[model samples]
Each structure stands twice: as structure tokens, then as C-alpha cells.
Target: MVFFNLWSVLQWYLRPFIKWFLRKTTRLCELQRICYGDKPGAERSRNVEKSLMLSRTRDVKQVVSYLDNTVLERSFVPRNFPEILNPSVAIILRAKKINPKLHELFIVSFRRCLAQIWSYRLLLEEVEEMRKTHYDSSLPEHEEKLLKLWSLLVPNEDLESRVTKQWQYIGFQGDDPKTDFRGMGLLGLENLLFFASEYPQASSHVLSHSHHPKYGYTYAVVGINLTSMAYYLLKDGSAKTYMFNARQYLPNMNLFHKFYCYLFYEFDKMWIESKPENMMEFSIIFKKFENAIRNELADPASVFRINIEVDTI
Candidate 1:
């Protein structure tokens, strides 16, 4: 009993020193990795680390604002933050010697902002690339995927051609579906394909909902509109809270796609619940939905996800 008491007393006394030592050692290792990692852009990443550290003395809000102005406004690419921030946080924690809790909050918030920036940049690149890639008849792969998507979503009906009036049933603007894709380009098509492929029953069910006699709506057109909504929310940083809270470190394409899925599902419910008079009221309804999303995202802890069961579909 005496030995146990002595050991416990020693442990209590030495715990803080042990923790400091561990932190120092880990920070050193992270520094080494940042400097010596085999990645292609080690130098550029190191430059970012230097820049971040140079501004470490700045208030959290100032740093966050700077990030918002700089990185968020830039073009997308696969980022080096995932590699850089691990050690950067350790170094910041050691160098700043701030209150542990405050230090943690700053680090976490900064990381979240960086993650949000990266996701936005990545998504922007994707959208831009898709916008530039016009649909071509020569690409068998693209044609096949489009056909497969149609088959998956509308299994009962056979599409006669790539261009058909049947496209209107799914919410295309006209007989030539490509015309509708002029704004969103291939990204709209890709989003639809993903929806149909990933959630076959849900996609079909939503299609059926689009055909309601009293309050029918265009599925594909509305989907493209929702894509624009998602893009705007992401671009304006309104979706940051949702993305940050939903993820531990960073958001990626899968997460973005999930957000799209959530929007698609929720928008359907909202439409049914509101029971608008006609398609002409779509703009009004959409504005209301956008406002609702913005309001929800005003909360720091908001996380958007598809919560409805698909088994019922």
C-alpha cells in the first residue's frame, strides 16, 4: 500500500513533464517529415508552413480572415495541408505556449478553415473541368455511362436515342438534353449519374415524386438547380460549418457528393410539404429552401446528411 501511494504521487508529479517531452519529440519528428517527405511539392508545402508560423502571433480571427481571402479565393488542387498541419500544430502549440484549451480551439478551427478551403478549391476545379468538357458522340464510355444511368433510374422505360422527348420526363429543359447542360456542363450529368447509381431506389422514388399529377416538377432541371445551390453555398463559405462539423479533419468529394444527396432528399420533402401551385413557383420555392439552408448553417454545429430510410423506396 505504501509503494502504491508513492508511485501514484510520483506519477502525478511527473505527468506534465512527460507530456511536454512527448510533445516536443513528436513536434521534432513532424518537422523532419515536413522537410524530408518524398512528396513532389515538399518545398511549396514548407513555404506554407513558414507562412503559417510567421502569422502564428496574429489573433485567430485575423489569421482566419487572411486564409479566407487568400486560399479560399484561389484555384483548387490536391493540397499539402494534410501533411503540413500535423507538425505545424505541434510547433504552434509549443511555440505559442498558450492556454492548452485555447491552443486546441485555434488549431482545430484553423484546420477546419483550411479543410474547407481545400474542399472548395477542389470542387471548383472539378466544376470548371466539367464545364469545359462538352458531351461528344464519339466517346463510347461517356455514352454508355449516361445510358446506364438512365437504365438504372428508369428501368421500366426504354430510351430510344441519346436525344428524345422522354428526357423531359426526367426534367431536361427540351428534347435535346445537351442544351440543358449548357450551364452546369458534364458536372450536372455526373451528379445525376452518381445519384442514380449510388441510390437506385431513392432516385427512382424521386423520379416518381417528380411525376405527381397535382404538383409535378422536373427532376433533372431541379437537380441542376440544386447543383448550383450546392456550388454557391460551398463557394460563399456558408457550408463550412456543416463540412467542418461532419468531418474530423478535411472534406473531400465523397463528402460533397453526400451533401448533394442530402440536398436532393431534403428538397423533395420540402417540395411535397409546401405543395406549391405550379412549376412557375419553383424559383420562389427554391429561394425559400436556400434561405432555410442558410439559416440552418448559421449554427456552428450544423451537419447536413441524408437521414431518411431508402428501404421504403
Candidate 2:
């Protein structure tokens, strides 16, 4: 902790001098040089954010805060992400006096990088709000989404009652799923619903695997477990590598659910292949699975494509 604090203080003092020297020698500002040097992906986005944020310029710092604030309200739309970023990107370019016409490529790359960077912030906000929301039997909206999850996963049959043993068929520990949702909250339900609705065939396949006589595990519980895993990965910013590199996925709740689907599908494959003796092995296997994901997330180039690998579509 002491070392980190000193390092932080050192960077605060030295960064401006380094930026000035780089600007003088390369005839490029920090942003230009970073975008120019790093390929257009996670690494680039990460550095661009760090560069702008570390900048002493007020406008550059404001750019990040503005983007952070943009996602907080209900009015924020994914379609308008780029539209909103245009002026902020302009702010950044103007901060260093870079001409948009002269640096057309830079402008394009910077905007894409910003989209990936800030959309991630939006995801963190959304995840926080969802995780904090407890499953309530009283709220109709919560109950409706919970019922919708059941319908999505078990469409051929109707749930006999709101609180019954049927919940265990989907992997809940008890008849009342409300109790099981204590940990991950609505985020778990949302992730499960996304897998069922968006990738129905794939989700069904994984759900079927949960009932394997020898290797069977609880489907919904595993999903909620994976949601807890996903929440930490996203929360810690470890997911940026996959999130930023997978440019096809707009950073939104769907993108997050898409990530959860990958974990669920992969875990099913792992569990069946490993052939663990019983549920007792679940804790060990789940830990290994999470570590494996963390390892994948370590690579800035790692990308996710659950649709390509598992979706029937």
C-alpha cells in the first residue's frame, strides 16, 4: 500500500513532464501518439482513457466525467452513444489543438475507442443498479420478470405455482426462488432470461445438461453463480479486454448478458467433460472456471462470440 501510494504520487508529478517531452519530440499530443501507436482495440481504449484521465488539462478530465455521467439517467440510449461522444471527442482534440480534417483517421479511431471505453462505464452503472435490487415477491415488475424467466426456460409447461418444487427443476435450492436470489439479486435473473430468450436453443441445451443423471447440476443456481462471477469481473474492470475487443457488442445490458451466456455455456461443457462426482465438487470447479475466465480476460486481444460458438442462429 505504501509503495502504491508513492508510485501514485510519483506519476502525478512526472506525467506532465513526460507528456511535454513526448509532445515535443513526436510532434503529436498524448492522445494522438497513443492512438497512433496502439492498434484500435482494448489496449488502445485502455490507454486512451488513461491518457485523457491523467492529463492535467481540465477539458480532458471533464471529458471522462461527462461520459461517466451520460449513462446515469434513463434517457441514455446506446444508439446515441457515438452522437453524444462527438462533442467530447472534439473537446479532447481541441485540448491538444489537433485538426480534425488533418487527422481524420485519428478522429475516427478515437471515437470508436471512446465508445468502447464509456460504454463500459455505462455497463458498470447498470450492473450496480441491478445487483443492488433484491428480488421482491411484492413488486409486480420483479415477479413478472421472474415468471418471464421461467417461461423463457420452460416454455412447454406452466409453473404449477409461484412457490413450488418446480423451482428446483431449474436448479433453485428451494421452492421459493426469492430466497436463492439473495446474493446476486435481479442481475442473476436478468442474465438467465437473456440466455433463454436470445439464445434459446443454446440455453436449452445447457439447461438439459443440468439434468444429466451422473453430472447433473442446478441450472438456475449455476447461472446465478455465474452472474455473481460476471458481476465481479465487470466490477473490477477485468472484463475490459473482452468488452473492448468485441466491438460487435455494444456495451449495454445485452452485452453483459451475452458475456454471462458465454460463462454458462462454457461451464456446462467443462462440468460434463470433467465428470465431477457430485455437487460437492462444484465449489472447486467453479473456482477453477472463474480463474480460467480471469486468465482469458488478462489478454487485451481476447474477444467473445457466444453466438458464433453456441447460438443456434
What would the TM-score be for candidate 1 when compared with the true structure? 0.68
Model 1 lowest lDDT segment of ten: 38-47
Task: Report the lDDT of model 2 for residue 95.
Answer: 84
Best by TM-score: 2
Q: For residues 56-91, what per-residue lDDT tens digits would candidate 2 score against the true structure?
A: 788888877777777776434667865687788889
Report the Cα lDDT for residue 253, model 2. 81
Least well predicted 10-residue stretch by lDDT in candidate 2: 73-82
lDDT of 1 by residue, 1-313 (tens): 9999999899767755764585587643232333333221223232334445434245433544544444455533346555544554554556546455634545554444455545555565555677567766578976786787778887889998878998888888788777776777677777788888887778877888999997889999899888778777777767665666664434566666667777887889899889989988889889999999999987655667665577466
TM-score between model 2 and native: 0.91
Give the per-residue Cα lDDT of candidate 2 at 256.
86
User: Which residue pairs clash in candidate 1?
Assistant: none
After superposition on all C-alphas, the RMSD of every candidate to the true structure, in Å, is: 13.5, 2.3
Root-mean-square deviation of candidate 1:
13.5
For model 1, the stretches where C-alpha displacement exceeds 4 angstroms are: 1-83, 90-120
Best by lDDT: 2
